[model samples]
Target chain A: MGFIDARELPDGHTVETDVCIVGAGAAGLALASALSSGTGGARVLLVESGGFEHDDHTQYLHQGQVVGREYPLGISRLRYFGGTTNHWGGNVRPLDAIDMEPRPWVPHSGWPITRAELDPYYERALAFLGLPDDAFELEAWTDGKACRPWELEAELAETEIFPAVAPELRQLGAVRRASIEESANVDVLLHANVLEFETDDPPRAVRAVRVATLQDERFRVQARLFVLATGGIENARLLLLSSSVASAGLGNDHDLVGRYFADHLVIPPVGDLWLSDPELPLDLYLERARANATGRAMGRAIFRLPDGVQREQRLQNCGVQLGPTMPLDVAIRRGKAFRSLDYAWRAVQEGDLPDDFHYHVANVIADVDELVAGGYRLASYRAAYPTWHVDLIAVAEPAPNPESRVRLGDERDPLGQRRIVLDWRLSPSDQDSVRRSTDLLAAAFALAGIGRVRVQMPEGGLDWFRPSPHMHHLGTTRMADDPKSGVVDRNCRVHGIENLWIAGSSVFPTYGHVNPTFTILALAFRLGDHLRGVLA
Target chain B: MTTPFAVRRRDVLRLLAALGGAGFGAGAGVGAGAQAEAASRETLVAARVRLRLVSPESASLLGAAYLRDRPDEDSPAHLAVALGLDAGATDIAAIAARHRDDLRSGRVHRLDGFGFSRTELRLCALLYLTDRA
Candidate 1:
């Protein structure tokens, strides 16, 4: 059995390991997988909040795939060994070099290390994640064939196609679980909800992780190194809740633990590209499209702001995807009876593994128009039939807005910790990023042989509207060399705090328009290497 | 979340963010007390309006702009107040009544989720009828 299939934890009555990692989801498991495999005798203690997929919460809370306000039932994020990765679509993109660059307008921007440094780790991440190879790039590589992301992006999309990961991710997760279980030093614990970090110094040390479960019995696992790889919201929640040393919580010197809360600003299509060039390889292109889109037509190509555009503009980082025309109303309806459809054909419009739950309707309409009219039916199945065609979704870049943050709540959780009141505040600059991105899209949509397009900013404008539930929350605990700038320093370590590292997108200084699991898992791979020394 | 006197920039941003997050449903901005005292009351039809974020060039859009129905009458909190929110009472229905103008004009913008309300708007049409009351 693979790493994820084994429901049983490491056989033990409280045994010791060289290192202890909290959170078993994507980041946590990825790190453990890398560490156990790479390091010798690295005693590892992996703590999971929930159990296997069959576990009560996994099936009840996450099986329905509730997120944002969209889910019909109350959606609580799953606490498990694989964490949220189990639910992820696995669209992996390395943190771009420009993403690490300092933008004066973007407050709390800049990663201490460069993208080049993380390149090798990203490769390790890709391999572990079962993602496609990074095309011909020397820095990043994976076993999967040409990833084949559409080519609006000069460097990335042409080479990278994120391997369709819904089923495979879980399957590989099994392998990862067994490899770790068989290891002599590694001890895996199920239902281990790490409640608090009892620290000695203000920002210098972590003595132990106070872990507990619903059963009420709790124990403190004292490890020289304690890593919190929970997730974007949970990581910050834990920090804010652990009000032991500082009321503001651990590593929240500037109250930055849960600030700069961000998500993908999911833009609907203004129009689809009626390609003037018939020479384009359309069928071959569609096959490689990540198993996300459900319908037929050309694949998604990443949008890079023209060099001149990037240089002159206040652009942080942005990308866009070209998808077949699909209406929200129709998709929601089709999704209601999603079970019976020929999902193989539908996967083209959506992604590989068909999920009606979280994914935006990528395949409701296949852009299959009778005539070569620039505009087809507006929304075919749904009633807005006046205008029809595939649409362009311009994903704006994410900037750190101190105003956009998660705050602590007075209410306690089942674990008796303060509930994190997520107060995601976007700065004026973030709104500008959207507008600038819209303008760039307009310019590109006009230039690229695509069809008519419109850029729709939120009604209350960018600041006043909700960023879509695209599941791309990032930049709460940013990493940097300077203490004042970010939460963790280079190598994903919390500045000044020893033996406490963070894995996952929480440490990202900026966010790109891609799912973070692949790259984040990559970072975990790199971090696990650094941690192997501590394990010994 | 709100202020006693004029809205502070921080409170204003927080209020706007909340409204933006909540899709400018009117009642979503009720948590802040200061917004409650300085209520910009309007009718429901008058409150639900279109809006966009304010940037360098677009900030001009913030000031008074008339809606589809009220072409002449301008929005009260004209300069976009974060997405579409007014810090008022927690009860959304009451809050919607108090700040009808905020909704009618683009002073606040609604967050996403099939925002163009047909039914609530029909009720708002009923509200426009009883204007004198």
Candidate 2:
């Protein structure tokens, strides 16, 4: 393996390789690792836009404005060798069988590939992520003790397991960096930003990829195959930016390069659960209780609607997790510091300070006593092992909406490339699904005499609903058998383009409430196999 | 042998007492001082006509609270009909059964953000009236 800095390359230099991967994120690395181990003679080029750590220049390139909804785009993702995996929360779970199937109620739902197609690669992905293949088995973790008091009648809800990777192995980039650097057939290039895809006259195939560095050094990488493993938004932006030959863009014949963007909607502490039996053993679902013998929090158990119930009710998948409720005093103390910090960061992003900024700072200063007390309590054992009540967090799946898209804005970055304009939109049915699923969960708990759930959602429609993102960008370059419906084919190859494929959550046709890292790696491994055969 | 009605009345009373003593009232402590005040005999007798098998004092307090909150369902006749109890029935066992069924079937009314089955609501209403009425 060779580690090269883009600046070290001479200007107008050309490098040739068998396979060129555009992003050295989880997908790129996984694909590279798979290719290096399986494909005997293929030379792999792994290119990254940033160095090993976060840089201000690359972060600025990620800055974009929102059109339809207010979303923090720049701060949500990282730009480095590891990509967003550098700060990923480490929770992992494969998508359910229903998530891959098309629902009659959901317009642009369903994947060209099924769960069975990815099953073999999923095990490899888990092993690559440093977990046992059986990590998602909820019964193994709880031994059935964590189930509801009575069997939920008619299978209204089901429990799903989400295991957190080991703390030391959480940063996949750092964990696999040494091995990737030592692979004999791979070349890792840092600060090698891809400018555009230089294609033939018809734009039926990608000829070469133009790469650049912040220092004005430009080069070209011609490969037999190309993969844009960039994050979801960047993948679409790159495709839409490559307009040198096709005029519209490479593989943008149907104008579907950046449509149907989706991300998970997370609502923290939606309600409180009051258990009828105070001594009920729900430890499997709590953070501290789930900690293994090594004192690392192992995983979490979540509640979601069963497949049959989802189809019958015409609902999207919504996951609800139960954790210990934060004491009100602790919330107030933590909230002051959080509010002040959040406002300051947003002000910096906007390049202007708000009038009430001083008030937030003053409030934080005034609550110093609370801040210290809250910190001490959080570090103490009592805070970790709370048993009084349970707080419910709802993470709802996003239905693909063509109107929710990422497009090029008039504004350009320092490199003269048009910045992204993300217009994220959610349908009314999305909100309705969340409400209905939450009610069903409450009903199950109530009927079992386990407890009661007081849903704290405001009384009204989408106007009163404000959902935060889980930072899992998905469905931007969705996979479908038909070119008109999606950008990528079942094999993740961009439709209507030869030798061009996508590898990441961006190719996900539907994103279940689960995290996308596991499936992203699975797809990467699957693509690696496909590419090996093609290059063979 | 003790009848099922005796066990049910005792249980409801115990639950009501526990809620009041622990201050876990679903807003049941609006007028705490009223419990110190006594209801007139005529008022007690009038309230007692609505239900049987429950103590006169318990019946009076609960009936007044029930009538005050759900003024539309003025008497036990309406409450029995709403709870799926036999019309005009004053059986405590039947009342308890209806309460359990409501909870089991997800039929609950909310008061002060706390969910309560209709039977539990009636009892909570009684607790609130005892402290205030």
Candidate 3:
């Protein structure tokens, strides 16, 4: 394998390979690694827009407008060799089986493939992610210690385990970069930004991709097969940009290329829980260090609504986790004495205090005893053991809406490419899912005699509940069996293009509550195997 | 002379009533000494009736304290006692009336330097009121 900087290549250079994969993120890197080792022995070319480290010029290319709500477009994604994996939190869990099935309530829901079909690939993906096999099965990973007590039996809620690899070993490029660089069948090209796709007459098959460098160098990459592994937003942007033959875009004959965009809506702590027995071991609910045959792994348990409950209630899939919560008034009053003094001094210097200044002062005075007690507890816990209390936090699936999409904008980047316009919208059903799920969870908790849950609803109802996006971009170029409904086919191939395929979460028809990286790897591995069989 | 056991039980009841009154207002005590005397017999009857409302576990815990046995400090009854209430007071109705004004105003004063959180103190005040109501 040889590493090449496309900027250094001569002008009008052309490279030919058996398979060319665009975007060296988790999906692209995984596919390249898989193809290089298989018995088919096909040559692979992985193209990345940015260098090894982040470059400001390349990152600025992701800047765009957000028509609905304030989405941090420029800062949400990083354009580099490793892609956004460099900064990901490494929370990995497979989507539930029901997420793939069509629901009457969820519009444009259902995956062309079922969970049973993807099970083998998910098992293989565990190895790629460095997680223990069958880690997502709570009983197997926790050695049967993850069970809830009989006294707290609630049919609506069940624990789901998330198995995450250590932070240092999770980066795809950093962990597998050496093997990829050493492989004889792979060639990695940095700074090779694919500008447009050149296709045959009628644009049924992509012939080659025109590449451009920041220094104005031009080249072409001809391949037997092409996979666009760019993220959710960029995948649609690239397809929309290639409009030579199909004016609507290569696979946009039905005008579905950039439609049906979705992302996981993460709602912060909406309720508080006070357990009757504070001494119960909640280690499963909290992040714990576990020793397995391989090495140390991190595990955290979350409560998911049972499939039966979701079907009966007609609600979207959601998961709830326990997190520590303190009343805002108490937290402010319980600061260190010196910090309180400093705050009081600052307020005095400002000439006038804000509203409820006297009330806050009274609270601080009232909390002096608690402050001293908390100091002792902190010192004692540091010397010996510790305790934890938590509130309920939830993540819910967003119903797919064609109105939420990404389109090519008028403004062009430094490379003369039009930037993207992200119009992220949430449908009424999406808001209903969060509200209904939270209410059910609260009822279940009260029924179990665990405690009461105080749901925090916005003053203006569910419509006013503004949740910050979790950056898990999904479903721009969604996959389906029919061309009129989706951009990609069942095998992730662009509906009309023969040799071109789409990878990553962009092909996901529904955005499950779980994080997308693990599933992305599974799909990539499955695609890699498919390509190997085809090329052989 | 009353035995120490009987005296201790009476003392605990008086303290509970005084703590409850303190949460209402101290002004409720002024010029109410005659009224408290009038209500003393009724207050005792009220305390007996309210004792039925407390959970059996809480009642047992309070009984253990009255018997001079070391009850669990985390027990609800002991928690109420630890939150600035004198456990050795006499005359339940008089002390309750004396602290009514401050109690009604929700004024909390740190009589003892014991480290109790506001939540715990509030819970203690609530327990006392529930018992005396």
The C-alpha lDDT values of all candidates are 0.52, 0.75, 0.70
Candidate 2, after superposition: displacement of residue A208 in Å? Answer: 0.8
TM-score of chain A of each: 0.77, 0.88, 0.88
- Give residue A218's lDDT in candidate 2 (0 to 100): 93
On DockQ, the stronger of 1 and 3 is 3
Best-to-worst order by TM-score is: 2, 3, 1
Candidate 1's residue-wise lDDT over A1-536, tens digit each? 12322223232223244577887777887777777665765567787777766366433322222222342122335555566555655455665677777766566666777778888887776566554454324223222344322234242113233234445554334547667767665667776667788888564688877766556666667777888987787788778767778677888876678777676666555224323222323332232433223221112235555434554666666665555445553454344233223354465545666455223233323422222122223334424222233445556666677776666656665656666556544556655665555544543332222222334454345445444546665777877777687888888888767778999888888876566776687788888878876655
Across all candidates, what is each one's fraction of true contacts kept? Answer: 0.00, 0.11, 0.00
Q: Grade the docking of candidate 3.
A: incorrect
Cα lDDT tens digits for candidate 3, A181-278:
78999989999889988898799999999999988899999999999998989999999989887788879998887788788887777555534333
Q: After superposition, how far is residue A36 of candidate 2 from its true place, in Å?
A: 1.4
Question: DockQ numbers for every candidate?
Answer: 0.02, 0.13, 0.02
| Residues A1-536 of candidate 2: C-alpha lDDT, one tens digit per residue | 47789899999999999899999888998999999866777899998999988999987889898998788898888889888888888888889999999988988899988999999999998788767656777655765564422344447677777788876677777887898778889998899999899888888889899998998899999999999998999999999999988777778888888888889999876676765445567766764224344334467677887898788878899899985555654475357775686667667766889898888778778876776776676657344333345778999997898889999999998888999999999888888888767766776665555566767775568996788888889988999999998889999999888999999999988898999998999999999999989998
Task: Give the TM-score (0 to 1) of chain B in model 2.
Answer: 0.39
Task: Name the 10 consecutive residues with the lowest summed lDDT in model 2 chain B.
Answer: B21-30
Ranking by DockQ: 2, 3, 1
* DockQ, 0 to 1 scale, candidate 2: 0.13
Once superposed on the true structure, which residue ranges of model 2 sit more than 4 Å away at CA?
A143-154, A288-297, A328-387, B1-71, B87-108, B115-133
Ten-residue stretch with the least lDDT total in model 3 chain A = A381-390
Question: What's each prediction's TM-score?
Answer: 0.64, 0.80, 0.73
Q: What CAPRI class is candidate 2?
A: incorrect
Q: Which candidate should be chosen as best, given DockQ against the real structure?
A: 2
